[model samples]
Target: MHPQYKADKPIDCPICSMKLVKFEPTPNGENKPMDSMPGMDGSSSSTSSQASNNTIYVDPQRQQLIGVQFAKAITKPLSKELRVVGKVSFDETKITHIHTKVTGYLENVFVDYVGKPVKKGDPLFTIYSPDLVATEQEYLLALRSNKELSKSSFEEVSFGSSSLLEATRKRLKLWDISDKEIEELEIEGKAKRELTFYSPVDGIVTERAAFGHGKFVNPEMDLYSIVDLSTVWIIGEVYEYEMSFVKLGQTVEIEMPYSDKKSLYIGKITYIYPVMDAKTRTAKIRIECKNPQYTFKPEMFVSMKIKINLGTHLVVPEDAVMDTGEEQYVFVD
Candidate 1:
């Protein structure tokens, strides 16, 4: 019979003359399971009397069986997923260039510096144009004629001066002059020598091509580059080899360098440049964003995450999944 080992003392196995492994006793007076410690072997003890009689050696099989059982009950399951990198860019459609409809000197500058925000119909600059002055004169003459004919018969108002009034108003409107300006001119009965040019859109003045006071500007030279900062693009440059994972309308997360925060932007592969850049060895992809608060600026560096969906596939934690570079592995427990 095997000798029973006491919980508080190190007992020696009489048969092998070796020290037996000690363990804490459970509430039922049995030893608590220790995976590292050896257990009772069936060959050494077939009955309870034999187990406590003389001495019996611990068995390796029992330790392994307990270990297997513990692992099976507590281990977690994990799956593998794919990860990729990308970049941020601007939406080309949202971009526009601010230019002049008439050729003249940049007499005055209202939007004085670059990066100045201007709203639609907000006067950007005032230019003294001889042609604009001539148009104003014609409009004034037509207004005066219509007023004079209004005292007469409806026939004169409709036929005698209608065609002339319509013709003059069309010329002023063609030059983007608002009807309000025309009404103000008619009431004041004065010709405005300088024409005010308003911003065509809501945007920031990106480039001030407008030369200083008295600088000559023509249609050939751009006056100012107004950019709407509300929306921007995230450019994802995919290599020819990595093209499969990047499809149109894939959702990606962008990481900004300045903050720990990240933004989720869904990208529809709007434009894929047909030709590859010979120098970069990459294809150009255009991403559009609606940056209302102007958080994103031009040329701001951004990290992109392109997740490839395997469709109903399993996914694992990035830390738990061990990447051997060539392969991936995960621990069961």
Candidate 2:
């Protein structure tokens, strides 16, 4: 038996009835000293433990295995890009409402359908009003009276007939009659039962109240609403905290939803609504964009991005910062 493994008393194997040799257990044919392990009382190990508490040390192999990366902090110009959802809408300034100046019945609708584009002076509908016909007849009668009285030797009779004719022509003009129509009436020497109404501006018909022909229309009724799509507005809601960054004339990028196109629409911030939405805590901003192609339609969902220069800032990797529920912190190397 080895002297290092010798026991204080002799022990015999039960089966062999002979003295048995005792030995210490060895793992992998070696025994290690406990003090040589980590967290031991040795000075070197103690220092390493203390340093590890303040610093993280990862070997190249471990770092590669964990996919760790590093970045440097530097001073540079920075800009914050705020993203928000917006809606496309019509430019109200270019909208025109078509209304009848006199009570009438819609005799015929030339530009009959909603969304149909019309130009200035294009015939929209013809209206039949008894009062309008009466006015036309009165003007014709006054013109004939003037012609007959012009031969009267008395100058007063000639002047009075000229005044009556002038008054009658002015009344027809007040009723929205175009000068061309009145001139044609004088040449033809007749009054038509219906007068055709023309569009006042170039635009698309957005709303139409005159559906069926011969429907009674009053001066108060809106017969048609036309909006010019050459210019449009994109209205976006921005958070109150981000309102300070918004400014008039700032250019923004707009992206349409569910579109396969990669190019974004560019718009300029034209107006910022003074009031904020109480429930949403956001303010409204209007961005005006040109729609010469007539691609943007009203009520379309869109996304907008506005970039604001924040000047110089200390920049770091986004992953370097840690955000706690109540606060934010970062680890320094």
Candidate 3:
């Protein structure tokens, strides 16, 4: 038997029937009780002795070494700010594609370059189509015939000439001939070899397929793609679990990549895509922001922040929580 097991009053060890020793507290204030020793069967006696609700005791030196911290549980309003990355894009609703309605040879290129700003009715290009010229000549012939037949004594001849004139006018209009151009043609009493086409929207040209003068273009070809940048969209995705916190009209803060703290742009959530992405498990969202100064450009990456007010609730430091496989718990001081 170990000399440390010697005692004034011999007490038998429950495990080995040997003389037991009384326990003494160590300098660090930890006590090794005899009952905590292993039994004769080599089973931990403390396992059966310790209660499930027992407190876990740690010495001050060990606590200091482990860097344990304490925090008070308090009720306070908690707001969660969700940060996400987004990409700047042009507003789809404001995008316009200009396509020719008739086959023609691109005669003149006015708005020649991409990114050129243009307004509605601004001349974009001129096209020369043989069919369009023929239609114009037919309209002129009908106009001259109507004038000559107006004095006819036969009412049938007058009505027939009037019908032919109206039919020719409708055909020219169907061919995208503007009323102003038609009136000008009527005044000049001649056909223009080339007709100028104007932009239908105010925007910057984003794409131009027409190259050089006299390129043969058909109605199926997209001549120009214009995108109005007055209002732009910030597209982002959020975890599907956080979908409830997002709502239409919610204000979002957009920050440019590598921008300063004061360079945040404000926008409103316009849409939340209903479908969730299978791979990312996220839902897409759209935010609309005014870009009158053209500060935001398409394809630029930005950061978005949204604050969700969760109201007052109990809170604790994140480090305080511990997961023990089956359950989560926290230690309180």
Model 1, 85-109: lDDT tens digits are 4455555666667666666666788
- For model 1, the stretches where C-alpha displacement exceeds 4 angstroms are 1-87, 150-160, 258-270, 278-281, 312-333
Per-model CA lDDT versus the true structure: 0.66, 0.84, 0.84
- The backbone clash count of each candidate, in order, is 12, 0, 0
Query: How would the candidate models be sorted by TM-score, starting from the highest?
Result: 3, 2, 1
User: Where is model 2 more than 4 Å wrong at Cα?
Assistant: 1-73, 150-155, 314-333
Per-residue lDDT of 326 in model 2: 89
Model 3 regions lying over 4 Å from their true place: 1-73, 150-155, 316-333
Model 2 TM-score on a 0 to 1 scale: 0.74
Error of 2 at 125 (Å): 1.0
Q: Could you estimate the TM-score for every candidate?
A: 0.64, 0.74, 0.74
Clashes of 1: 12
- Report the number of backbone clashes for model 2: 0
TM-score of 3: 0.74
Tens-place lDDT per residue, model 2, 132-189, is 9999999999999999998899999999999999999989999999899999999999
